[model samples]
Target: MTASLSYAHGTSATPLLGETIGDNLRRTVEAHGDREALVVRSQGYRATWRELWQATTDVARGLIASGVKRGDRVGVWSPNRHEWVVLQYAAARAGAILVNINPAYRTTELDYALRKCGVGVLFLARGFRQANYVAMLAEVRPNLPDLRLALTFEDDWAALLDAGRGVDEAVLAERERSLQFDDPVNIQYTSGTTGFPKGATLSHHNILNNGYFTGEALGYGPDDRVCIPVPFYHCFGMVLGNLACTTHGATMVIPGEAFDPIAVLETVQAERCTSLYGVPTMFIAELDHPRFAEFDVSSLRTGIMAGSPCPVEIMRRVISQMHMREVTIVYGMTETSPGSTQSARTDSIERRVSTVGRVEPHVEVKVVDPATGAVVPRGTSGELCTRGYSVMLGYWDDEAATKAAIDAAGWMHTGDLATMDAESYVNIVGRIKDTIIRGGENISPREVEEFLHTHPAVSEAQVIGVPSEKYGEEVMAWIRVRAGATVTPEELTSFCAGKIATYKIPRHWKLVDEFPMTVTGKVQKYRMRELSTAELGLGKAAQIKMA
Candidate 1:
């Protein structure tokens, strides 16, 4: 018989959960009511499961009184905060779809996202780093007709809770009872390296089950304390960090508002955290800290290193030095409720260090030819696709795009290049698409290209990801300037400073007459990356392996 096609399945004796986010929270609270549920050192706040449940219900009732209705889009634009966590469960409890807006977003990106989703109420932090959320929202809120209210965390959190006291508790209970497992509860804006971002509409069943399964892979329990330094805006924080801990009755420890190596080290030691979460760069930063030896991280036994692949060298050090012998790696996108595969704690060291591990429970994975759509044999590279309850309902309000991404058969095409061994171990080889993952943040080239085109000095612009040792990949732009338009790279930088995200701005710039193209005139981004890598003396950086 011919070798079987590349396909795999994840079996589970436990069935998928059929409960809403609120339902799951109530169940966990009933079981671990006295357990520590949340900790935010920046806010100097901590809460038990019962306290968290009370806070979430209060916020949910407040949202209802503030004119938020079921199916409404509620946006939260802030860094990792205790309010952000409360809003997450509260919005779900009130039957509102929570929209996670990136904290790094500027006026243009912010306005586009809020308007695109028709967000009714926005909760925001005033400022972080150089970006001013208060001013940016002020500049854009008038244009956002759907945005009836914008509440600042510094001034409004307490008032929102007080407003809930006026509403009847029965009303909040009714709203929670109306929510179902399949109801769309969260809209995560995913830029997948193309154009403006798309809101990946995920249901309660999609993320809750994913979080539960991920925690199970780590062998979590109520005693496990998870240190999460990743930002809450992404699935890495909300799903894998918070949701994962909540599902298993574990404590969620926030290192700080933003990721600081010292804060992570300090939090782990002080909190006696058993688990930690971050991208590979974060692990590198923590390990390479000048005072690394001073902190005792012996409490850590398990965690996850995701966003990008983890190098073997880094994995070795993490297991030995960080005392994370059960460290795991997860593989998925925002559309798959953010996790379709994860490494198990029992995986062999070689497999744990090298692969993305096996398919997730209640999920299926297959590698197939990009053109033929036929399953490829084992050890053959092909596009990776997943199918299961974890897939999103679809991209919010983008039916055509959704159809293109998820096939009629329900397989979510990942557009990622991968290979499977006979043992069904999945190894991510590369991407079929172009995306610049700078220090774990996914940057879209088209979004930056469109913004640069608005510049009068620029006739055309193209962006590519160049190899970087620091960020794994940094953005590079090649521009065809309009004739007689004398614009320097510094001028372009200044123009983009307050308009777009700082990381999305091109780190390398080149003035080009024209781009290399194929016979059909498709601009070849690979050629641009190659030429830019050679010209910028980045060969040494390119040679440094991250996986």
Candidate 2:
């Protein structure tokens, strides 16, 4: 009757794990003591389970010696590096809340995060790309009186480690004993479309179990070496990449301080990596690299392509050329420790390419009508919501925002519009806010963007609704053309002629060098919309709609 609005719960005999991040790390180290735990190619760093444990404990002791007590907020602002990994585990071991600061953040955003979370200690690289951390810290340090210490990855960080040697081992051990599974241990700021970012406070149990299950889905083990090019600041890296590896005793390989296509390819070939992780764009860069064929990626058996929907062609190429037959698509936000649904290694290629697979083990997912909050029927588009242990405790220190996000019934309302099949595989349509209403017809930008990606000359496409006079809103696309290839708007729209619905096709097109992206590689559509509207003189269109 009524097709019974979509809802699915993961069924499994494997019960949820009940241990803190520190405890789980110790367990995994004992199980795979001789196995490689970390490898940072840029820094030429390598560590086995024993060595990594000792190094992590040293950092933990250093933090304690520096006056970091349990539950203190410690901010880490750096690109992917060996020190970042050490601090991640060290903070958890020392019973401190690790606040991930985006390496892309400037002084203003950095100051807001530090003050919002009351961060007492900050760990940052001396310099990343062109942004000088020292300068930014100098700008904000005056306002951040709570910040007692600032350690750069340069010489200052060396002194921090040395400070640990003087502290008695019992202090570190006592801090470890005080940690609980449910105590908040991590704070990741959700990159909001408007206003300041809200910190998603997560506990050890939230991320640890999510990571273990994600790794299990990818068939990870002690022998699997995972090459991670994603930033450690995002849940995609810290939880999905690092936590997944540590829980399963797999090796975490860092290609560079930041994602480098050549570095990723070279690392995969040199290390004979078994697993890899990236967003779709990262994969595209690696696949399109001039020297792509030179690398030996045959060792790759599985990996993850997420952060956004994977285009069909890209997914096919990754499977055929990259040898990632078991590449999975994960879907979730930082609020849920990153993954609520994932494609499995056993999933068919069709299933892997089309859906985000079934609900993750021990999680419940449902699609509901946005207007009424009632569950929507199968194959019907609606807001996707999740409920499980993986959900964060709440946005840190923001009760009003937390209440608005999580309902009284405990569902974390993911603003994504989605549909479910009879088999329970979920298909993300687009964000609810990304919907475009043109002449009273609703259009999903994701649907049109996917269609445009099929064009041979289009390297990447991002669609957003810009203002219009004839219609309430019109579809506009910013496209990145293939290198040395050219395309005109007329020719491209003509290519879409019969394949897609007329209204869904983008009306205005702009060829661009690159799309504005977050540190985690998510395209900022709102910024694109703003820029397009101004350049196209659509100010009148905005007033027309609002009025």
Candidate 3:
């Protein structure tokens, strides 16, 4: 472990799971059948591990009876509902690739995701927030030739389970036995810088092992009660939240469909949750809540805080006030089953807040020179690359992207600049890519810029991330209008109102004739970010030091 070369690998004797997700669930149910497995406090629902398996079996058989063949894609577009968890396992049990759609997606985004994966059966909520999912689905259903049926949670939930009553138990057993651990089971749509999202296809081996190791790092057990408020659509929730709990036979507790600080506090106090999960912003909201002190969260021992930098002050408060003495920070992209490096429960406050901890078990991480693609010396900032079992199979149907990201030698070059310390602790400095992560949501600047170009008056558009106190970063758009065409900020806002997610909408708009360019005539996004920060009087926010 000298500081000469930047490379490390986790070696463990514990064997990785070699069975399908359904088999893993069966093993856990056999051991912890009567134990409380899931609790949706918001919906007033609770179920044991055995009950959950029965429900999951019903849905799996129903999917099979509905002409859902193995290897087909089943999409679920909703928030943190109890059924979302069931669908996670049911799809795996039925041999369908479960595609996780962002709940905040509007018509344009949803249409693209549903068509991209050729989702056969879509399960969705009727309405959430401002978007009427039913109406949006109707608008796009005609275009989706592969979409066979769309079922609503409230209307078709019972019917779906009942449809499985006639399915023979031997049918499901045969399907389960025919599956392998290497089969693709989940498709998570992650925003790319190329104006569209890419579906990262993951196998049972990739996600199941990552979840087990992450939970093992935190020492999760059957007695642990985890309160997860993160959305079920992302790896943070689907892999780390639910899979982590199920792998260890822990209880999965949902606070609300969407993030509500009060709901989280109340759920923790009422459920006596032992662990919690969220990004740093979420922890900040809970810690700063007016009635935060009134809740009894003494049951908490450990949890995960990730997706953004963990500030020193915020981490300290979370450890002290939230009773999470062992709160850890994880680092990885959606391509790595969502976790590659994680801090241990015994890490010091300095290491926990400053670094993303050491590499996880059965994975390898290294710092490499981006230009040369050669491993760099430790303590030197370079692009972080990971290679191991947790890497995704590839981007769905995009061979070029798959090759571009994961190299010929099997290394996923994470386009993130980082440095590995002498102790193998990693610290992320900046990203080489153009994706903007605001409030734990990855927003592609190209996607938003393309949407803005749809406006008739918009001649050209550029998007960048600016500093913010709350969300760590906020989206700002610079528009160059077409000649003889009139456009106002109000008009632009009105045009993008229901087309994109609220977070993707620009928080700051500037009408400009030309952008800052390099001598080679390329747009200098770094210069734009600097100028916007100065003009918007956000310099103070930008200077808020990080760990």
The prediction achieving the highest TM-score against the true structure is 2
**Alpha-carbon lDDT, every model:** 0.87, 0.92, 0.87
Q: Write one digit per residue (lDDT tens) for candidate 3, span 189-285.
A: 8765347789999999999998888999889999999999988888888899899999999999999898789999999999999999987657866
TM-score of each: 0.82, 0.98, 0.82
Best by lDDT: 2
**What stretches of model 1 exceed 4 Å from their correct place?**
1-3, 434-547
TM-score of 2: 0.98
lDDT tens per residue, model 2, 230-297: 99999999999999999999999999988889999999999999998999989989998889999999
Q: In candidate 1, what are the lDDT values of residues 147-196, reduced to their tens digit?
A: 99899999999999999888899998898888789999999988543478
Clash-forming residue pairs, model 3: none
Which candidate would rank higher by TM-score, 2 or 3? Answer: 2
lDDT of 2 at 532: 90
Q: What local lDDT does model 2 show for residue 537?
A: 88
Please give me the total number of clashing residue pairs in predicted model 1.
Answer: 0
Model 3 TM-score (2 dp): 0.82
lDDT of 1 at 64: 92
